[model samples]
Target: MLERRGVMVSGAAAVCFYEVCPTVDQYCQLRLIAGLSEKAKEAAEMALPKTVFAVSGYHCCDLVAMGRIVGDGACHLQLCDIAVHPRLQRQGLGREVVLRLTAWLDKNLPPSAEVSLIAKGASNLLYAQYGFVPTAPAAISMCRRC
Candidate 1:
């Protein structure tokens, strides 16, 4: 057991990081809690395996958070699909997930690697604490529908 901000965390309720993707059901549930759109199970199944790397946080066997690293391993990398269960937020579980993923990147990624993550408005601060900076006009993020 561990203590954070006066709260007792346990193997069952404290955050534990795992180097595995959550199940499709777990993914959908966590995303919904984190306010992301639900992905089709078929698409998720096809894509989850293609993830270059993934991390999940569990508390007492309950999957509470997840994140993924995608794109070419050497030159291009993006952090996507980060989510922390709504009921479990504000307890640093999200930070733990990101930290574990970034720590892995630090050791495994080549020197030429470029990493980026698209953040929601409120989450920019959380990410900024981990060295992420806004690129602004220098490189605007763009997206288009297929």
Candidate 2:
């Protein structure tokens, strides 16, 4: 897992994470983040051509199994779209990606840099291992359906 948010690269066998969007339209179609279609599109368009870091070990040469970091460098970084194909799950690829990204954060971000992520399901355990404690003391997280 290369940790530079938006830094793209390809290759690996079992570690490929999908390259989601080349445009906002594609991102909305894929992620379907509720009211986020328009906003996500704008962001994706701005961030496209940006190298979203990924990992892979599938031996195929695509970054099809990996995770990504999205945000402005330095201040705010959000870990997003972390996926390892269903076939690749339980093989520690996800953990590897998180660890790699954490290591990159440690090396690059300033001590005050704020790194964040929204985990899906039980995956919070993995993020916890990387020091992503819940934001409880600050505020409870919530999502509303439209």
Q: Please tell me which predicted candidate would have the highest lDDT against the true structure.
A: 1
Each prediction's TM-score versus the true structure: 0.87, 0.63
Tens-place lDDT digits, model 1, residues 1-146: 32222223533476667788888888878888889878888888898888988888777777888899998887999999999888878877778777778887899998789899898878988888777889897997887755
Best model per TM-score: 1
Native-vs-model 1 lDDT? Answer: 0.80
- Model 2 lDDT per residue over 6-100, tens place: 33232333233333332345344434432222444566666655644433333254333455676777888888766554544566666777876
Q: Any runs in candidate 1 off by more than 4 Å, and if so which? A: 1-12
lDDT for position 70 in model 2 = 66
